[model samples]
Target: MNNIEFKHLILTAKYFTKYEPIIDTKTDDIYAYEALSKFEIDNNLISTEDIFRHLHHNNKLFFELEKRNKQLQFESFTENKKLFLNFDADIFVSCEQQSYWELFLNNKKDDIVVEITENGSDDETSANIMRNFSSWLNNKNIETALDDFGQDGSMFSFYMMNGSKYIKIDKSFLRQIELNYNYMHYLKGILTTIRLNGQKSIIEGIETQRDYDLVKELGCDYMQGYFFEELMIIK
Candidate 1:
């Protein structure tokens, strides 16, 4: 879809249920529905990167969409459960934090976890910018989560310094942790460090019984994967 069409589609779109990992030993309650933005054209999700790129290119459209999303999130939270909002670091850094905080002030700030997804801008400049932006977010009581960590050599020191609250271990590590003892040990060390430093752990991309078993054994606090359920629309 073109940029204008894509913007309109996402602004008016409803949320779909994406899998969210649950605590260990949980079965029926192992997953939760996360909102997924979709376009009406053939009813498919627009590429997340494309949406952000359009937003970056079109300032007016970006502000409008952000305002609309903030309103929708506030309204939805009154009745719906907590929300894990996906945020591109580039878009986040570009926007005014005061505006976002004012919009969400009436709602529970802790209930809103900002997800910093992978595949966004990942250069030195981008990383430095995000570090500063994260510092601003931290002051506002907004939790920061580094989505899809361990995929690259971006380094975790920035996150630690910026006081990120959670780090989502990339799915690849979870997939192989069961068979690779050394890998598992490595992960355990990482998890231990994260915990020792007072950060939360989220294991993503889980899709099997064995995967769940391994993460649970490793004492992961949260999980998200397709094995529990695919994304679905709530309304």
Candidate 2:
């Protein structure tokens, strides 16, 4: 299934998309639900990563697939909860101007946060594209989060024009924080800088009390991963 015959597979308006809650550690309530893509075929769940990687060589396929994912997510939206959608910087930059925003503006703009991955290439063109797009999102009362914001030296520079209300501390740094003072210290430094810049920090991959206590002591605004609850999927 890795090499999906995506061209042959009909891409519907609202395909198989899943929503996972990002819990607020302070309130112990869900702050928002992130839209994820998954394909279920013959009692098997196929991850979006399979499609994401396979279609990189075909720009048109990638954009259509991602657009379909976004449509499904918004179609399933409940007014009470904010929706967080992870977007591909490549497809985001290539799409028609304000295309998605036009679709979203008629909805509750404040209830949406568009998350762009930390792993995307930060070339001048990509930066320029996201910089403009992010500014537009901010003006529309939409927030942005730099997801997976560690394990890369370029992240700080990446956030200047890119940073919004949140910075998701990558799960890599969350691993073994108590056992490794090195990890703890680095985590502290990252959160400190992020706070100083007026962005809330989300400690990702907190699956144990140790992870919880440590971030709590350090004053992380949010936490996500198995420690709170395994991500819930509609299917």
Candidate 3:
């Protein structure tokens, strides 16, 4: 889509934030919430991935929409829990933009974790950019989460993971475990390493009692997905 079309789409879209709770594995209480964006035009829902893919073409528009969406996410959330916000790697372009976010996120720093996500290629250059972005967030005293850990084609860097406060394992691992029971062993090893490094691990895609039981037994600090509750609109 051209800039004009993208601009019009943004103007006409009805945006909403759906918060999915991240449950503490032991107490089963909500430890945090991940704010997911939802968009609609003419009452028909639009794929967020599609919207972001288009947004990547223009960093200016990307950050503009990101600012609006994140503002709504923070405003609509009344719970006194940590909020995880996804930051795509491609948007970290200029120092001016970094300053704007640092100012914008000042008050909310204590209650937020900026999740580093890659919506595009995972080449070495992209990985370095992500590492730099994570460092910037860290210097600002904001916590960071390495999102989609171990996903295919997603960059997995020990340098980045070591600095992160949280490591969120990808949801596809559930399917991998189903295909090969030994994958659980591999996952358990990873979890052990995560614990050893003093970082918490969040396992996603827990959709059933069995899924919950297995991952909880395998030992994840937190669990998230459809098993506990679906995405909820607070207002």
* Number of the top-ranking candidate, with TM-score as the measure: 3
Model 3 local distance difference test score: 0.85
User: In model 2, where do residues sit more than 4 Å from their true spots?
Assistant: 1-5, 10-15, 41-43, 95-97, 118-128, 152-162, 176-179, 230-235
* Residue lDDT tens for model 1, 23-138: 33344353333444433334665544555566665655765665665455445543344566665444455446446654564365656677665435556776776676577667
lDDT string for model 3 (210-230, tens) is: 899998788789999988775
Cα deviation at 154, candidate 1, in Å, is: 5.6
Candidate 3: misplaced stretches above 4 Å?
A: none
Which window of 10 residues has the lowest lDDT sum in candidate 1? 16-25
Please give, for residues 1-235, the per-residue lDDT of candidate 2 as tens digits: 4335555463632257667778787777888777777776445667767666677667667777766677677887764788888865666554473576456544756677888663255677667666666666677677788777774544455544245788888777866565677777777887787778888888787778877777778787888777655656663
> What does the lDDT read for residue 185 in candidate 3?
90
After TM-score superposition, the amount by which residue 144's alpha carbon in candidate 3 deviates from its true location, in angstroms, is: 0.7
| TM-score computed on alpha carbons, candidate 1 | 0.76
User: TM per model?
Assistant: 0.76, 0.81, 0.95
Q: Give the clashing residue pairs of candidate 3, or none.
A: none
Where in model 1 is the C-alpha error above 4 Å? Answer: 1-21, 24-33, 47-50, 53-56, 77-81, 94-97, 152-156, 160-162, 176-181, 230-233
